[model samples]
Target: MKISIITVCYNSDATLEKTILSVGGQTYKNIEHIIVDGLSSDNTVKIIQKHQDKIAHWISEPDKGLYDAMNKGIEMATGDIVGILNSDDTFFSKAVLSEIALFHTKNTIDASVGNIIQHKADGKVVRAYSSKYWKPEKLKIGFMPPHPSIFFRRTLFNTLGFYELGFIIGADYELITRFFLKANISWKYSGITTTAMLVGGLSSSGSSSYQLITTEIQKALTMNGLYFSPFKIKMRFAWKIIGFLKK
Candidate 1:
């Protein structure tokens, strides 16, 4: 099966090349790398041009935000399975996509989810997130699989819906809630380490980032008609601490 990897960026010059090379090095060959740049002022566009041969499709233009750029890439995707790879992230191994393809081919599922390592820009490990504990019911308590580690069938976007542009930090959470909880899409955990995610992305920075995401998560749950409590949302921090302790 062909897989389309969408990478959305803004001023990502320093790390974009590593992201590009990761896709190029994937053992899975039937892959298309699409880039949506938000009119970066840095050398991000120049880096894209330098490795144009490795990129299948790319555009540099003003966008609403991260989710908007992702929507553009999803609309441009032509593969059967689609995934988002942030500019600061890279595949955990050359065989990451290969493993995803193998697992999906063997199972009848809408999405294939995996694990991820959250690390520093210098490559020091912060924590590893696994999809093993995730369930649709956990949405109420703000549990979600690592976004970068999920490879979804492209049809989910058409059948269910796209990311809610209304959200600033919780579109991913909202989308997952919409799909897994409301729509009840079938999914499986592949137990593969899919991506090495950089810390300090939209949802992973600091206490302020946590507050923003918690608020957004509650908003997402409410929008989906799911039961949520501010107290339960705070409880997710305990789970996060457990995740860190696991490392």
Candidate 2:
């Protein structure tokens, strides 16, 4: 299976190289790396160009935001499977892509999800996240998979829809909720860690970001005819604590 891994960045020179190199180091050779940059003013584009040979396609231009650039990468992707890797994240090991390929070759799945470990900029592991508790019916109860560790068939976008643009942080959440709860797409789950990310990302920290997440989750669930309750936000944190403890 040809998997297209997309990385989107903006002025992320310090952290982008590790992400690019992680994709380049994948043991699965059928992989294609597509990078979309938001006209980075620093050395990000130069670093991208340095490793351009390993990249299947890349472009640097002004974009609306992270999701917008992701949409652009989706448009450029030609592989059978599409996965987004954040600029600040990397596949956990060189074998990750190969493992994904093996899984797809054996199972007829529309999507696959794994796990992620989050850390601080200082490289201290903060917490680990997983989708083991996720079920389509649990969408109303504040359960969802880690976005960076999930891979979807390219056609899944056509069948369901692309990430909605207006959401500041919950677009990935909205997309997966729509896929599992509304569109009824089946997925395979792997216990292996696909990516290691730094914590305090858009949906992970800050009071403002949390507020935006709550509002967007509400909008996403309600608009899709699923139940939404602000009260469940605390339960979400409790579930996260369990994830941390399990790690």
- Give the backbone clash total of model 2: 0
TM-score for each prediction?
A: 0.96, 0.94
Error of 2 at 121 (Å): 2.6
What residue pairs clash in candidate 2, if any at all?
Answer: none
- After best superposition, candidate 1 residue 153: deviation in angstroms? 0.5
lDDT of 2 by residue, 93-151 (tens): 99999998888788788888889899888889887877776676766756778888888
Q: How far out, in Å, is residue 7 in model 1?
A: 0.2
Please identify model 2 stretches exceeding 4 Å from their true place.
239-247
**Model 2, residue 90: C-alpha shift (Å):** 0.9
lDDT of 1 by residue, 1-247 (tens): 9999999999999999999999999989999999999999999999999999999999999999999999999999999899889999999999999999899999999998889999997899998888987788888888888899999999989988899999988999999999999999999989999999988877777999889998999999899888777897878889778877996
Cα distance off (Å), candidate 2, residue 219 = 0.5
When summed lDDT is taken over every stretch of 10 residues in candidate 1, the lowest stretch is 235-244
